[model samples]
Target: MQFTDEDLGAWVARQRWYAGKSHVPRFRILDVQPAPGATRYLLMDDAGAVPALYNVPLALVDAPSEGDAVVSRTADGYLIDAARHAAFAVGMLAEMGVDVGRVTGSRVLSGEQSNTSIVFEEDGHPTIILKLFRTLHHGENPDVTVQRALSDAGSPYVPRFLGSLDAEWPDSGRESGVARGTLGFAQDFLPGVKDGWAVALDAAGERRDFTDAARDLGTALAGVHAALGASLGTVDAGPEQVASTGLTWRRRLATAAAEVPAVADRLSAIDAVYQAALERPWPQLQRIHGDLHLGQVLAVQDGGWRVVDFEGEPLRPMPERAIPDLPPRD
Candidate 1:
């Protein structure tokens, strides 16, 4: 079934991709196109105070495609197809005369939660990974923002950002409005290496050692820290922030304890780690990985780990999700 403006608005509100829930947001169709028998649309809105965009590409596949077609079921919620939702994205970009040649092949990257991403090769030179941002926050995204800064600083570890495609606001050129809303990003697709998380999981699942993987990740984390510091200098970690970190940990632990009950007994053990972190003889301020996990690193063909997706955890607020953050605060 196709979505009318009202239907699309309600449908977007119900989506896990919607991102904002506190207010009944407004949506404007910036562009539209026919996709064979399907309908492609680009939508923009102030999701509460968060300015966001969506490229809603839905196929009228004889009835309606199940919710699972566009969203992947996850432990938290459905993961949106930020990457492969291209029909509408193409329509949106068409306004700017963005040329989309024939598609070669498209594959969804694994280990995604909120956003959807798909990699496509164009004549086999400079493959592009299109990322649709899941959560919308006003202002430029820190992932794109920081990565661009790092790229400008000549860092080669992160993929070279090519450009972004999004919908332009109709009233943007007017005295008081936004010019465009970001829809997706096109970046150089790194080839070959399996994601660090998959490698680690394989090793663990096969009863093999993960020491090498862990060590490599540790080293990559260090390099990422250094590069980030070079790009965005260190800052002081205030006592208030430090105390707040401890309290946040406590609250997280408390919530988990409430859910699992037995975890309450291990609070002391967790506290030991926290206290050690606080007492460690290290710089309290440095630009470090805001969200470092096994999956965020990749083992390259050269055997060194390449850090991927500097976009911090989606669960965190936008302000705290970027690098140049107080190292200890992370």
Candidate 2:
């Protein structure tokens, strides 16, 4: 079944994962590939200031599907989100080279903004959480590679990396007009647990001292940093790198000033601070969790802190996010 411009574009425009919500989605199918139980589509949207590429895995079914998973109904039948389809649940694991027989049950994990995740159970316990990247990029995903490196370095702060599914497709953003990158990743599922932020909130509500837990969180963070530095190594910021960083800061300030009038007045002052910082001695840059906040971490019961979601800033384009960055930004 083929999606018309109206149906597909309208559907994409309505998605929470769609970054260009303000602009009407102008989608063009860049490429399509047939995979087990689904057809994977590489869609491009030029409506936004920055063109975005989307990874859309779809399944055509004869019957209607429940909820938002249903994209549209056609004469051919219904086009549904393959992630919700039973066969797709089994098929994606096959793509990751896992045996389907071992998966006792599978269900979608909700409240995610950027990706779709399916929790696969084994022996009646959720064991693996497979996350499919909603946006397409042209290189390896740091969430997979970085976490795998940490796991290999025997870092206890990260979940055990299982495997990843990657693919190659045409991308105008790439100089070669084609690129290869991870499509999804499967990792050990850390069951229901409150994140540090949530734990802190509870502590505050109960008027309890969280000093020890906060200290432990800091220790865990430092350990992860050490593990990454040992595994990925680090490099001193060169003159060119420092200059580039300053340029980025200025660009971000300009953007903020443009969007918010209040920031416009302080733009020059902010620029001066950026210049001052650039002149100071620089710290070694290494691979770190680019986007590290309280929400990105989980406080497992009696298991210490287990950091997750290493995908970097969700707003930044893919290739740029995968680059080594200053660890202090975490």
Task: For residues 1-330, write the lDDT of model 1, one tens digit per residue.
Answer: 223566566667776666667777788776664542345566777656656656576543222223335432334333333234445444433332435675454555665656777676566543666676655444456667666666667665677776665444345645666444455565667778788778877888999988876776666566666777777777666766566666777878888988886898887898889888766544546555567666677777777776767667666776666534555443
Candidate 1 TM-score, true structure as reference: 0.67
Alpha-carbon local distance difference test for all models: 0.61, 0.84
Could you give candidate 2's per-residue lDDT for residues 122-196 as a string of tens digits? 889998889889887767888988888998998999988877899999766668888898889888898888987
Lowest summed lDDT window (length 10), candidate 1: 59-68
lDDT of 2: 0.84
Indicate the TM-score of model 2: 0.91
| Clashes (N, CA, C under 3 Å) per candidate | 2, 0
**lDDT at position 322, candidate 1:** 51
